[model samples]
Target: MVRAQVLHGRVLDAETQQPIPNAQVGVADNRLGTSTNDDGRFVLSIPPAYQAARLTVALLGYRSHTQALPPLPGPELRIELKISPAALGEVQVTGLVEGIVREAVARIPRNNPARATQLTGFYRESDNDTIGRPRYLVEGLLTVFKPDYRQPGDDGDVQIRQVRKVDLRPAGQAVRIDWAGGPFIAQFGDFVHRRAQFINPRHFRDYAYRLGPGSSYAGRAVYVVAFGPRKGNSRADCEGQLYIDQASYAFLGAEWHYTAGGLRRARHSGASSRQLRVAYQPYAGRWHLKTVWWQTQARLPIGPPLNYFGEFLTTAIDTAQVARPGYVERAQTHDVFLRTTVAYDSAFWAGQTTLLPPAALRQALLDQPRQQRADSLFRRRRTGADSSTVGPAARPTPRESGRLGFLGRLSFGAAVGLFPLAGAGGELAVRYTPAGSGFALRGTAAVATPGPALATSFDYQFVLTKTLALRLVTTWLHGQFEGEGWQLGANYQRNLRPGHRPLYGRAGLAYIRQTVAYPVGTFDNPDDALRVAGTKLGADRLSARLQTLTEAVLPTLGLGLELTHQFELVADAGYLLHLRTRAQLQLDEESGFFLTRSSATINLPNADVDLRVNNQPTATLPWQPQHWLLSVGLHYRLRP
Candidate 1:
């Protein structure tokens, strides 16, 4: 039979001299435990077998106290545990300082099983060097009021909100998502690696011996320790030191630095880099991340130029997609900052497991968005600043602004020689504007190269005003037989309407130069055929087009039907004018070519001749005075 003794205890706040109800009391080794009632009194029953064992007392947001009990007869004993605010409040720092923190943290066992928890507390964070003023020095309290609960059949829902100075809003916003997920356990485990990383005890076995000695800060005794990668191990992204309370072994603060060496290449063109920082007095005993302030800088090597593959003309048979063959390498730098805080309510921690009433949870979730909007409105009302407005009173915009935009098409209708007859190409554009309307210049280069052929183009567009636009476009092409060309045109657009859907009309004139090589014999070898064509082929083309455009229909499905008429005066000297008009069609909803270009041949040089260029008198091919080009395709406006 087991002999036992019962002990009684009362927990009280040291500063307030008030009893703390619902305080937890338990044996150090056994699971036997009970909590104080409304009167802050607890009765603990211990077996005689544990006469020499210690008993631990704890309360939410309070320091845990342990004491050994002497052998006793069947009698009720009384004990008192005092709450120390400083000892009960501190954040957990992993990595280099984890050992020091674990000494104090191990004394407290997690009693609350609820995955979701709301913490409300004040915070003060700073750097370890103390060179300049702390980055986040403000003191404020926050409440989760609503914690996200992931129960069976529950919808994925997350709600987070907080209030702080405009300057501090960024840090607050960064953590709101984590807080809504519940307590820091999930976020902590996710951020800190428990395997061979920071939080793993196996990896940090030598930490205690390496810590060396203790130190003092601001008259408060603190233990200082440094950490680095173990011998035979490569350098890691993180390194840091911890400051612990020497007396209670509690973690007072910590400073850590991280560098993603290889990851830097993934960010941008430049040399890879890393960062360092410190966090102080950010949370209470819950090991909650209060506030973290870090500064990081990186250097990345410039990367190779982007390769875009796709088609240019949506309609055309035997069209090739073009690719931009250029290289770009650049270097960049960046600075970042972060902070967070948590609050706790003892009452919420000492309760039975029960689903939060639906009505309460609903109200809590809804209140979050409303609070954020209210905060925004309040700030605008208080500051009287409307950033959307323009004019002399508006905020000045930053200099050096540019945008990169691209469009491409790739499609195939059928297989040829076990390979799809596909085409792909894309365009790249860069623009610069010193002022909104003054000296705006834009440059564009595009290429589409498919099997057996390639087409490339370059264009420059200059907008002098909201109503005037000037453009110059030129193209060069190469195919199985060889071809090249250039076109120059200018258009002026005048807006007829100003609101939501604006209407505009444009007119332009174009001059084109083209050349094509034709085979003279049945050349079975491609290289031999090319050599023969180059030696005996006739190639020449000079064309001028006067065009008029009119919009007849426009609809929401992004389908626009426009009528265009162009007068083409062709000067094809001697060679046949192989006028092949084609269209390549693709559906916005699916992959693959939906339609091929409608083609009509208007043969030139009515009289056939044996092509010995020197023997044929220079002759101009049949000229067509007017040509009508109808374009029927879907053009969807991208969603904002």
Candidate 2:
């Protein structure tokens, strides 16, 4: 059993009475905390041991507040914080901004912890698609170890403890955001520690600074300094306000957004705009990172801009008895945090204080898109319990099994083959499935080579149980030869590797019908044959199309593996039992009937010709199809 006290409330400004979003709410003298959502609403879960501790609320440019809890499971409370009058007047006096900024930069080693510290926190990152719809969300409980503030180039390491991936895109759509090292954004965004960009003393000359009126953050009087690119400066296109504690020269917090010039420069790299906020709180003689919030736009050259939002709230900080994570435990700089394979822990998540998304965002995450709901109509639902059903009594229908929806079920595949047909070809396929039912129907139109044949197939699939399926398929081949084939097969499919991007395998065997056409003798053009042999011929060389129908029953074995979610990469191989075949042809003319008695040799390359007969190959013609197939391709699918 798990237990935690639930404290819920809203934070508002006392003077204007407006909701204060992103305000930090935590327990006094401890690390547990959460941030207010867009609407300034917050819910914090505290352990029973912290019942006697006061709740502390703080936001940049506002006075801090600490109050005792009213009661267990109490009513929602309101926290109103006010701006300091003295700080307001102080902003009007804009002098000494540069001096303060310089002093803060020099005092970083003194204000921040010089030794390594491990911080345990909650990290959440959500991204939207080109159309601004939610693409996906990732939340994790993380342990990060930071090097000393005095270290110049060492970025810290992160060990992911628990993570959950929520696929919110309307099914079947590919999310293109790299999203690698998302957690490092919080670690690397510490400008005071990294001393880069606007905060670095070396680049200070590139920016012009001004003092905004005074302000207070975390109950400390702070000097609000605003900085922008100086005239004729091209170092960086950044402009923002920074909060520096007046007494300790410590940075309280900062808010920054890209300038127009910066955006223009970023456009070259596919980013349109970027904004960031970093906040810190003083504790035990050193300032500890409290939270970092960031939002950015990635402007795709071909689609709507993608928007991303992320937050890292320091829930617990351990300055003493801190140790760095082992090398294998540390998250690499290129690793995608959301794709980590750690299992979800419901109890841990339930006990942690998580920042709730806005109501609209929450709804978007829970409900399917209208098109998706419409597609679900085609799915068959299970009725009363049936003992014959192979899977669980309560399993999602085939249509709902995959992370993607209706449009995602339609896919185009390409593969190379070595038997029957010996060239590469592509196929476009559409699949339909019933809700709660394991049955599915698929249709495909394909074109392949050696003979460059056009083919079509219809497939029926019944999932016998979770991870296993039986399929019956029929196909027709045309173009160079007219033929038909069929197969009865079953396959086993399951996630071989687990992560945000999953990998799966499919292996099956089938009783297959193999059809192959053998080449017959070439025919001469009627005009040329008449001139050369003094006889009218039944066919022209160029127009003479020959085909033979022969088939063999064989057992076929196949295997396939697919990786990733939206656009999947699949590799496949097939082996079939070989068989010897005989061919016979057909004729449509009296002349062709009489020509069987005559013998002639003809050269007909590039000749205009027509076929009066298409027959089985003579005994002298001897060529056979190979017995193996292999291919690699990219496509989408209704995951089973």
Candidate 3:
């Protein structure tokens, strides 16, 4: 085997000097190529046979660049490309916009290959959390068996060959979307081959076309036609430009994005924006899909918005004697590549022409070796005790339990809780525990009537028997109202069932410091009562903030129902201790309300009546200030 020379480079725009992402970089007329990443960086491995070949860089709407290959071990190459703006002069002068679009659509079968083709490509995708934090990254080498372009409704079959992924979300967080079939998004979004709404001749009446400046794609001058929903069409569709080869009417490339109205009409879509770009290259007298890029922004119901991206670069294509992937090797549409694992092979990666991941992901890839070593050590230490006597079934390994990943020991949940005092609210909970450890950390937040509540706790569990366990829980900074008081206490937890979905009972005592406040309307007849005492507090409403400290007993019951291996439904009911709620009335000059005052004056016929602090002024209510809480939620285990 001959060693390959490694090449590193960056692509930028000539005028703006800004990095150009998704720019095609490769050797022309061969099966060696890769696309630039979001940061405009790329790495290519050149075989000894291609040492004399010149490198080519191209992007839609940009002038293609070519340069001679530099010697091995050289500085990073910088290639800048100038924008090739589409000039509308010729297109406007012709005034045949719709005719051009219709002709292009009609020539699709003639321009594209009618025979089946096999394409082997490298695919990569990254997702960000609502706050733009990297959530996960997945990269895979896959093969696509593309049917004839004229075939109706056959998107193609994909088989993942080698795959690897990393989860970047913080531990104890849940990502509901598993991103199944992510790699095939580009193929499914092929508007040209699929005869998208705006491109189909039958739907031409539903769209209006305008002539645009023509640009070059893959060294061909293409006719740029802009199209959108027709006037009063009332259709949910997109607007974009189509790049059709002027000489052959072949659709070389197209870029389109969803409109705001389309996104609104897509119920439960959560997508605020979406865009896609695809380009085909002429090869062997036929136009073949060369590259595809797609991105979407989704607004989540909770937390931050999520951003998703996917890119596919065709490395090699075979049309002669092409074989389809076997049934066993074919991947299903619902398969999540990230859930499958493959050993990280540095040699394999070093030999493939692939896009370079971002800096953070690159570092994570480098750390894989260290993490594997740690996992091996942990397994040895844990299994050493019964290596000779223990059978596999008797002692389940961490891998069998799906507890080998970074977040294997964490669980997250979201719920709706109903409190007698706080009303209905939403709650989020997170729990983290190390493998083979009885100690865990838990944090929770709730939003309700009074205010949002936040609490953190430390728990230690003791296994008494095979079916029962005891847990000691200590919580602090637990409260219902912001800037109000907090609770610090300990609780005892007992499992009701073992070796099954969780069912438990809790009992404990806690000390709470709280401030209770009420509006003057809390009293039914305050004015009448004060008038009977000949003390008229001149105010329509009287409110007060009262502070107090109390000790309370807590009792709760909880249960869980397994939904999937990684998720469960959980419910709990609990009660807080009772206390006498109080408030002092005073007059506020700004709002004309009485609140928290020590003394007050009552206007009389001749003079004012002075009222001092006394126990007789207190009002006794018939209601208890205690609270009862019931919560139902979904919990997810981070491992699987």
Candidate 4:
């Protein structure tokens, strides 16, 4: 009788000692394997077919670990993974990078899969909009029949096993995503299996490279190569880092992004931007494409940022490449944007596979249970002997559950700003955002005791992409200090972030119109004291002006400790525009009622600059009084 044993383990980072979730663990030639869960724990059933086989554990950005079959006196295994040394340091090695590339090119076939294999995979995708919300998400299970590894383009076929999805399309979105054909897109991302679909093997000489230190992958060392277009070659190009297996000179994985040259060359290609990555591992004997991730963003000429993100995670379930005649015929192969299966079978997924099922997916299939049946299966296996699986009623995840309706998309917020000389004021605001939609509307009512005033504002925002937006605001106010004022403004801001830091650059144009209250005859006398000037007056006067301005400023980027997901620490610092302040003198003709009179536009002192500051009588800001605005405040926006 063959001996079978069950094993449990947790994977962790060697240095941080923190659990590393999503690590893959299995034995060579073994029929069963599993991935660590959120807590970095996994349970594996050692199949009798490979009781003596060694186990392999791997994760992205870390060195892989290998060990003999488990049950080495202990009931559980704890694996600590160290960071890959290849990525630890960076040094210029351009010649070395080019040499490695040459070697990898010649040995591509030997380093990659030689035969075909059947793969079971889970694909999930999510998108973050301008507002930084996970508004769109999708997942699919697939069965892929790959052709010979060397000839990836010849004919790899895919069939969807099951699918699930959720989308919160921000309201009034004219652009609704049609994910019906995304499965094929996922297939194209398999640079190892479908190698020819994206980058060409023969074009390696056209790019430039810079080599970094070697790193560990799948228990082997790999050269870290960074490459992009060379010199004045402004043509479209792929630029990113690559991991090349040092022994066989095969590319184990790569993370690539498009460069400006690439964008220029592909201007007519209908491709805007892409961030892609793919990795492979030795699965069921030979190398199998383990993971493929790609996110594409649509270029907006005048619209919101629209993006598609796809991930493909594969496990070798079976293989039949040698027995098959040629490749699956195009006519026989299924082609599609993956559609969610209207009905899901709970038992089908419960069948053992190498990879752990995603928790959200299991939750969807298990009749909306709070916890999955798999978690119970593990518990029973741990505590009770001779465990049997339990199946739930079959049904599709509710369609209505994915929708974020009117109230769900509404966000309310409040803010208070110190007006320096004018005193403190607060605003109550209501904002509405449609899921995945790039548009938002805000209505605000404000009150200030020092200004002893009441005001209201209506604002609108439309995002063009991650770093850009168009803002429109109109405000009406009445008070003793501010007088009856109405302001209309619009700005287009481009926010550029510098890595994960709080520093960012902002450049935008703005238009402003407002009414300013000041005592008459208060202008600093400049007409040579000898000349007679206007007499002093006790009555107040109102001056309404319109200004068109452009400014460049730096603002902070990133979030504060989230008391609530929507609560944020917001801050801004920058210079306002320097422009002519134009207005008609509406001096109080009688009892504080202003009458229109001829007034000329004013410039800053010496005409060099009017440094927009609170004390500058000629300057009026859209929000606050200070010439140079610096703001740090607690901000909350409804996220539900």
Candidate of highest TM-score: 2
lDDT of 4 by residue, 453-498 (tens): 2434443444444445454534444443342322223233332433
**Relative to the unseen true structure, what is the C-alpha lDDT of residue 130 in candidate 4, on a scale of 0 to 100?**
56
Tens digits of per-residue lDDT for model 2, 433-488: 32333322233333343543454555555656667767665666655545556668
Candidate 1, residues 1-640: lDDT per residue as tens digits? 7656656566667667676654545563323455554456655555566567777665433566677774555344455555333331244445545555456444222311124333332222222112322222212222222122222122211112221211112223322110011221112212221122333455454333245355543234556656655554444435566555565554444555443433343233232333323222211222222222333232213322111110000000110221211111100011011222222122332222111112332343344334555666677778997734332222112111111111111111110111011233233232222222222223333324323324444444445454443444443434432333444444354534433233344444444444332212211111211111123111111111111111111111111121111111111111112234221110011112435212111122213211112233322211111222212122221101
- Clashes per candidate (backbone, < 3 Å): 29, 20, 4, 17
Tell me the whole-model lDDT of each prediction, alpha carbons only. Answer: 0.32, 0.63, 0.61, 0.51
lDDT of 3 by residue, 1-640 (tens): 7688889999999999999988878774545677787778988888888888888888878888888889965789899999886553343335458888888877878988788888878887778665444556678888888888897488777878788665644333453455434578646767776887778877788778886767775566777888888888767377898888777888878888887777777533788898888877766778878788888888777754668878887877778787767544666554566575543344556677777776656665455434544555567678774344323222111122243444444455566554333333334232223233332324334334443234343333343333343434433323453123444444444556555444545444445444332212112222322331233433333322221232355456676665555565767666776654442222222224337322231221111211112212223221123566555667655543
Deviation of model 1 at 385, angstroms: 22
lDDT-sorted candidate list, best first: 2, 3, 4, 1
- lDDT computed for candidate 3: 0.61
Q: Total backbone clashes of model 3?
A: 4
Give each model a TM-score: 0.28, 0.57, 0.55, 0.48
Alpha carbon deviation, residue 269, candidate 1 (Å): 8.8
The TM-score of candidate 3 is: 0.55
